[model samples]
Target: MRIPIGRFTVPPEQPVVEEKTPSPSDKEAGVVSEQHPSDHESDNDAISSDAQAGVKKIEATTKVWSKSHLIAAYIGIWIIYFVDAMQQGTGTLLTPYVTSSFQEHSLTATTSVFSSLIGGISKLTLAKILDIWGRPQGYMITVLLMTVGLIMMAACQNVQTYAAAQVFYWVGYNGISYTLSVFIADTSSLKNRGFMLAFVSSPYIATVWITGPMAQSLLQGIGFRWGFGIFSIITPIMCLPLFFLFTYNYQKAKKQGLVVIEKSGRTFWQSVVHYFWEFDVICLILLSGGFALFLLPFSIYSYQAYGWRDPLTICLIIFGGLLLIGAFVWEAYFAPVQFLPWSLLRDRTVMGACCLAAILFVEYYIWNSYFTSWLQVVLNLNVTQTGYVSNIYSIGSCFFSFFVGIAIRWTGRFKWIAVYFGVPLTILSIGLLIHFRQPDTHLGYIIMCEIFYAFAGGALVICEQIAVMAAAAHQHVAVVLAMEGMFSSVGGAIGSSIAAGIWTGVFPVKLAEYLPAESQGDLASIYGDINVQLSYPIGSPTRTAIMDAYGEAQKWMLVGATAITGLAIICVVAWRDIKVKDFKQVKGLVA
Candidate 1:
């Protein structure tokens, strides 16, 4: 039965069909192979056992869809990914302008640290929700959140409200992206899985080109509010088809008894309590609380007049460190459920992939946090040009990532390719950035480095993504992928914190050091606003001074980014050699 909501009809909920225990002969004949989730918390197949049968049904029949039906499904997935990417890409470009409008531009990286932590946890929660309730239900929830975020952003009166809205936006964004990955995983065999993922993620290529132009139009035309408002309306509509398709197929599978939902054989209250323990609520709380306390100081310290010496900042840093320690202690000893299963923790490949993913974010954000601002201020580029130059990374990465996918399929080896090829190229590109990122270097040389880094980074992304997915059985892929993403998001937050810390601490001093004595009094105003820096005429004394100061900061940032990225190379080199040719997909179980 469809639930009507004004003009739209919600997809029919799955009809509850109680599972039956199979007889001895049925078991002997291989009529069912149901593996239960661990009784305790896990990153394995640890959703409620009742959801397993439904999920099993999805895994089983996904490969059995008629060719046309499969095409339609693929089409829906592509549409969902494309629209979401379009919105996220354009919106990300508009964010600094919005922050600048509130005259609190310093808070940009700080707020992202908060949001990434929220988004990380939210990714895991939604993965669980989608795995249990059904994809459409999760999709609806995410879309609702994203729409709310967009609407709030459009209506926001201050920096605080806008930051609050970003949390919801990230949740929905991560959820939708997660769904897209799972959708591809559900359909593809290991043989072409890498290729399939790349094909679906191709939207980034378009968004790189399109969002720059679109953001420029919105920035110079009506305004960011209109842009946000328009996306609030369009995003949910664009997502409807994909979730509808997934729901229809899943419900159809259930109706035909292709699979069955199991009874947990527990009372309502017991099951509720069971899930709380099973989802590792305590662990999540500790992790979030601890990381927030630990990470926020990096960005917020500058806000305090006393800076690092402020009692509040010092207290928060200490408290945050203690909480992080508490989280580890709880996970290791007192918790019934834990964030990562010990088995996964022991898997070198998975850990290596996780580390590589995390470090990449740290590396990227170290320099990336302010490169666009550098472009506009030092290079005298406008918003559109700044956006275009910035997107050279996205453009090359997305396009060549598609190539990496096919290369992985053809070469049938990921570990060595990343270690030997992706790693070295990425290192070279970043090394080039150290020299060319300065104001004296021509812009074309800088673009070339970004392109080179993008190509290598693209390959590295696919390698790490597929490596994690390959390590886990299909049944656990959602959680595993979510976990890797969690690592990345947290790493990104930390990276943002480090960058923000360096920027806030160093940029002001550099500004003061470089400016003439007569201009010393204007240093605070100049440091606080990018607009003020850009207002100085090109080649003028003030502009030239700002360039030299900014170039100094950029030099240090790029050095830090380069040093951090070397860790990713170590991760790749230490990765267990898993070849695509040797992979097996049996009943969604990895081999």
Candidate 2:
């Protein structure tokens, strides 16, 4: 019907033309009524369908890398891990040799402090590097640093040189590990990520058994130089394939216009300035330095003339505490980019996972720091025997970690495994170890404790990784993972320091009390030289006294670890149950 308009003519209403449905023959000829009431709605429907199809096409293009590429990438990362495991296995055995060569038993604790501090710092640094420059660049830099560090260690002639070499090696080791973790997170779907990570760690199984015997042979027969030198060459070779694969894929993506590399269009110096600001170097310094200075005193107190009363120690503690406070403030309020995002603290899953990891490492290191020496002194085992015994824990860890990965994939739940299996088994193992930590305890019982502890500990590791990743946004995975690593490293440092303090303080005093009057004056020599202690005849009073003293110290350490493990169970229970989503689902949601 026609109606009167503001300025035009008013016309009488005419009979309305009703639209008729098209016949089948007319529909086949693409006929449509011009007067259809829903003409605009039909056009909108067609546009919506086209848009949905376009999204699907884009997703398919973005996910173009083949399964074979993923498999090759996994293998390449596994090779890097294998090399790292070899270093770890041999490094444990090298401690005594390094100490003896330097004529200082305290070097052991000092080196650990340096390694942990550098390693923690490297994790934070590498996280930024990977996020900014991409994974291939980060991986290459880590391998290069590690190779250089190994060469330095192989050629070192003094404790100072060895300590410096350790700094380099540990930093690179942490970087490599962190980068590989991020790569796994990027490639695997949430449901299968646990298994992929565990598979990467499978190198620990073979390296644990082989590196021990190899370390023993090298240290006893030839020397530590070759031990360090051989792996230096192997690491770079293993890393090459992964580097190439990443570069190839990145370039391919760029060529396809699927990814854009952002340029700041600044001069070289300006770019450097931007990168420094982007990496938040000031916060990095504050955090890393604070941790190092504060924790270093624990390792060095025994060597100080005044122990904890030393002015230097007091200064370090105060300064470190202040720097840590500053770091928190800057991260929370000032830094453009935070090394630790305050936002993550709001996530119960991230916090719980981080806490669980920190607690576990603290307990693990408390016993680990002195375990080999304890085995040697209390059990009268040689290097090879000690390696074999110590590695039982690792053997169990490898087997159980792999099993937990499969279970998580099957059940699609990680928290239950941690609560039901990890916590109780770990606590039980520690309790048994504490109970049996006596001079006359059976070796079989000790081995059993290690086996049980490792099995549960391995599962806990898997749980933490899965939990943290599951809770994080895909873009923040690297940073969150690195944050977890930093916490765990800090925990290791704290545990090592405490263990050092206890062992160094108590063992010397106990040894002095138990030694015969005639031999009492040689406490310094006895403490410095494991070989000198072993020279005492078997079953002699001197040997028995030293063994008893070690037993006492080890018992206390186990007690501390047991208490920490109990607390970790609380964290395990508190972790949130977040469902893992498949890659396609995540992508769709993001789109």
Candidate 3:
């Protein structure tokens, strides 16, 4: 999906290449060979047929459009991104409130765990769909899922139903993000890829500031339900143009013989069976189920009447572990087609990128999952004030990443910057947070910590993204990138689970320990809603107890986050230092 630099003009007619999977009989049995062509194979080495098709597909789809089409596509993509970003920003504001209504505020992170698991994994599935059905089909499917989830969220009657809706929304959310990311990767050369990647997320800079106030107003006026309902209509509308452009261009590519369809002659049912095997559906199911079961316990086990002693909790955790093991065994020994490109599994740079992203996400989510509530309750901030403080990490990340992207463009490098600044900043942020996240700390101090973490988080995210993509050629971009996103999101799921375990387990105990003896009877109410905690005046016994409880519970989570982030440095050092100099050099990956 390479476009001409600056102009984005369509390429010349390409040769027809039939789409199909690599055969088990051949060495390139998966979607890609286990070794990179440049790494192990000489220039004269014969490329496999499936590799040729893949390469050709990438070339053909690099098809761009006229000036007007380009403008429309560029605008459409950004607009859709803006709408989605706005929706998410507001949704985050409302989720705690929704949980409070159900008297399940403590379960907020638990709900997010399910969503992150589903959404993160959906990237792998969407990548496969893009490979088989084309980009437009995958994009439209995600849009549909997103709209349905939005509608369900507005209408959901209970926490269980809302959790299901959250899962649906997250799947679509990850899918949309994945599609947009692939779009950027498909169009830009490696030299400018870093900048482009950061540029797209620039919407967050504005949305972050606006969403809090906007959501606050909406909550006061029409309510959270209407907010979700309005967005359900708006997001899909913004998506229409991009969907049309991809579909139109794809059909035109097909007509020009630049894109060839598979001609496997089989009945419809047989074809379905073939794709099931080709996609390794059973493997995906096992993987998803394993993660869901294993992670669910950490988030929900404390809520059970029997707690950790519950037989159901023990069985679920054991079965989940077994299922995960089964998935690994299957992927390693028996799957016909692997989810990630085979060579990606062997690429040190790619693995390092995935590991780095996973580590960052794990650390970020562990402390961040319940951070807003912490700010509101402990600092005595309103919803809008909490939003202002909460947005600093993300806004700063986007703000810093844009400049870092430009730095990457000029330097033709990223690894050194990440090691020197990103890692150190992360360590510093944690160190500051240890002090600032305490009871009655000045609000400015907390913001300072967030700013540091924001820079570290953004830099690491951009570096890993560029590192992973730079290691792969055009043909393997979607698969490798999807794998990275999958790992990152899975890490987030794990972090959310840990946070849930800590917050639910430690927070209530702390509350019980610190609250006045007479107030013990109201423990459940205070534990479930920050609003109730906020009702008591500052410096009062009850308020003091609440603040002390919040501080003690989160102190351990911050320490754990900092401890986990140390692994990020190892990931940075392990990467293969590839310089992005020109699109033609090393097929636009390495200089």
Most accurate candidate by lDDT: 3
TM-score per candidate, chains pooled: 0.88, 0.86, 0.92
lDDT of 3: 0.78
Which of 1 and 3 is ahead in TM-score? Answer: 3
Local distance difference test, each candidate: 0.73, 0.72, 0.78
Model 1, 73-145: lDDT tens per residue?
6667777778887788788778777878877666667767877787776676666665555556767898888
Candidate 2 whole-model C-alpha lDDT, 0 to 1:
0.72
Best-fitting candidate, measured by TM-score? 3
Worst 10 residues of 1 by lDDT: 23-32
lDDT tens per residue, model 2, 1-591: 111111112222221111111111111111112221222233221111111121222222224455566667777788888888888788788877777677776456667775776687668678666655566777889889888889988999988888889888877887788888887776666677777777888788787677768877997788998888988998888888888887776566446544433444577776666667767789988987898888888777777889999998899899989999998899778877566666765677778888888888788888788788778878888887888888887777877887887788788778998999999999999888887877899999998888888899889999998887776554456767887898788888788887887788778879989988878877788788776777787698888888888887788888999898888877878777655533221221111
Which of candidates 1 and 3 reaches a greater lDDT?
3
- Give per-residue lDDT, candidate 3, residue 480: 78
Each candidate's number of clashing pairs is 0, 0, 0
Superposed Cα RMSD, model 3: 3.7
The order by descending lDDT is: 3, 1, 2
